[model samples]
Target: MFRAARPFIFRLDAERAHWLTVHALANAPWAAGWAADPVDDPVTLMGLRFRNRVGLAAGMDKDGIALEGWQRLGFGFAEIGTVTPRAQPGNPKPRIFRDVGSEAIINRLGFNNGGVDACVQRVARHRAKGMLVGINIGRNKDTSPEQAVDDYRYGFEAVYPVADYITINISSPNTPGLRDLQAEAALDGLLGALADTRARLADAKSVHRPVLLKIAPDLDDAGIRSAAAIALKHGIDGFIATNTTIARPPGLSAKVSGEAGGLSGPPLAEKARHVLRTLRAECGTSVPLIGVGGIDSPEAAKARIADGADLLQLYTGLVYHGPGLVSRLARAVSTS
Candidate 1:
């Protein structure tokens, strides 16, 4: 059904189709059951319990303003926002792309959002459904690397109450020097400072919400080691395994090859798995890792479990496959 509807949607802008899908799913009476049953992907991560392991990734809900619809999709959990402290229109239009043949997407969205305050109020309104809601936090484009910690602190404090767990997104290549925060010295300081804030928030609230770090897929061996080590040192609760890659890789060098954006979907699957395995091995068997990037099927989600991911998330794959993809993935995992 979604494939038949794709032509009309494909004609519209990517962002508009995204909102249209959100509204459609929200109104569909059967979407809740359609997206959420037959629990094969049951879950627990970072001391928090998720009803399932499948989740929507950060970019899907950039403002936390789209929860009512997402919760109905039957995701064991849903993460909203790579929200910044304040609102800013991201990069220019045509920043998002679709590679139909690969069932993938490439985007340079640049963290455009309605800001933390608005997102907090909106997310708080629909958080009643019991599904885990994660808020992905990021620094605004204008924030210098030196001031990044304060930006993260602002977002963490503001969005903390409404989220089940919070994800720190420092790996996006589009942001100026943002991924540089992943370095050994920078990661140490950033994670250490973030941990202090997380501890304070946990103490005051009398609740321990996990703080998970999302990393880039392009890191070299040393970078991964340093990142994993710093995460442990700072008491970071979990890891998102990866964000997007800056490297185009051998598979995706098409005519759209030079397009400046993060490439995701099929071509990214293998490397994403490798990174998940690396993080899992580094963090040891006990540390929780949520895998993301290029999850297109129940098989891929299952591959994640096999690769040592405690859970999984999707964005690009969902766009190409449409609404039914969630149920397909959920059912597949349930049977596995």
Candidate 2:
């Protein structure tokens, strides 16, 4: 059904098509039945039991609007948001462009969301559904680099109760100065604040939800080492080794490739895998790593696991291949 409908969906604007798909899943009474149940292959990471290792990445369901839908679609877990403490409209229209030829997407949508309060409420309402949900939190666009930690702190506190885990997203290229949080001093300060806040939250709530740091794919070896060291020093629980890349790959459409945004899909696989491998080497076995970037096939999924990913995530893959890709990858991982 999705295969048949994708052509029509793809005909719409990229962002519009995304919203349409999410809305349909959220509203469809039969959406779950449409997807085959994923193979049962459980893995425990962050002390949480995932039914499988193939997770829906953060950017796909940014507002937690379709949590149950993703689980029903065969994902082991679904990460929602890159949400902010306060709501803000993202970049101007046409912020999302599809590179059909490259089977990729370039998006500068920013972290446009309905704010933490709204997202928290949504999670609270759906937490009983039994799907593992991770909330990816970021600062509002207007928030300055110096004040960024406060926004993340607020986001942590707001979603702590309902979120299965929390992700501190500091790598998005759309927000001005957001990537500055990845710098040594700035990252150290942010993670230190987050660690203190997490400890306090754990003490008060009697629950310790793991916090993962999401970094950009544009980093070099030194940068990767610096970030990994900072994460380890602060006792950060894990790392999502990449977000999206600011650099365009060679031979992409000269027209759409020049757009200003993060590029994702096949072009990101090599760089993302390299970063994951480097992080795995640096962090060793102590910290968990969620590999995400251009995984569109069962072979690519297997490759990510081989490259030292404890788990895997997909956004652009789902955009290109439809939901069936989740079950296929899950089965492949389970049997492997």
Candidate 3:
């Protein structure tokens, strides 16, 4: 179905098609529990039980609005948002682009979304029917570094009830001073508050949902190691192997390379795996890792598991390869 419709979808601006795709999928009968049955792998990681191994990455659904639609598409899990404390229009139009030849994308979408209150209501009303769900949280674009912890805390507290797991987004190169939070002191402060918030929210007769940190692919060895250590010290639940990369490694044409944004898709596979392996070794096997970045095929998904990613995510791959990507990845992970 997607293969046949690809040309039409491709003809519209990337952002418009993205919303149209969401609405179309949401209205499809297959989005409900009875229609789209879960894949059989039954992955259990970070205290959440997912029906399949493939997850829709953070950026795809920047607000909670698309969960029902993404759910209909057969994903084992769908992560929505990089949602901020307050609403804001993202970067100007033309912020998202496709690199057709490279099977990649360059996006500088600066965490656009309605505020936490509106997002929570939207997800509560129209969330995915039966798949695992994660909410990725971020600070407002103008939120100062000194007040970053408060922003993450507000997001954590707001989404805690609705989310299956909460992903703290400190990566995205488009947000100024956002990556600065990755520094040792800044990360420690942020995670410490979030962990405390998690504890306060988990007193029920049930398990506490995991709180994962999404890191950047651009970090050096020292930075990666420091981030892992802070995660351990603060008892962070898991790690989203990477966000997106500002550095375009090699092999793409000069025109696409000149686009200023985080470059993702095939070129991100190896670097993401490197971060996954390193964090795995540092955090030990106990802390689960959900790998993202360049996971378009079964081979790439399997490679991520080999490199220590217990769960997986997809974005650009879905754009280039189409909707069947999740079912195909679930089969590969199950057989492996």
Using Cα atoms with residue i matched to residue i, what is each candidate's TM-score against the true structure? 0.94, 0.98, 0.93
Question: Deviation in angstroms for 156 in model 1?
Answer: 1.0
Candidate 2 overall lDDT versus native: 0.90
Highest-scoring model, TM-score: 2
Summarize candidate 1's per-residue lDDT along 56-127 as a digit string, tens digits: 988887876557666666677888889999898999887887777776678898999889989888778877
Clashing pairs in 2: none
lDDT of 3 by residue, 1-336 (tens): 667878888899988988776666656635444334446778777667787888899877776666765666678888889898999988888888887778888999898887888878877776446667789999998988888899999998898878888889999999999999999988988888888877777875255777888999989988999998898788778899898899988877788889889989998888888999989888888888989999988888898989998889999998888777778888888843
Candidate 1: worst 10 consecutive residues by lDDT? Answer: 29-38
Which scores higher on lDDT, 2 or 3?
A: 2
**lDDT measured at residue 321 in model 2 versus the true structure, 0 to 100:** 89
Return the clash pairs for model 1, or none.
Answer: 35-74, 40-334
Off by over 4 Å in 2: none
Stretches off by above 4 angstroms in model 1 are: 26-41
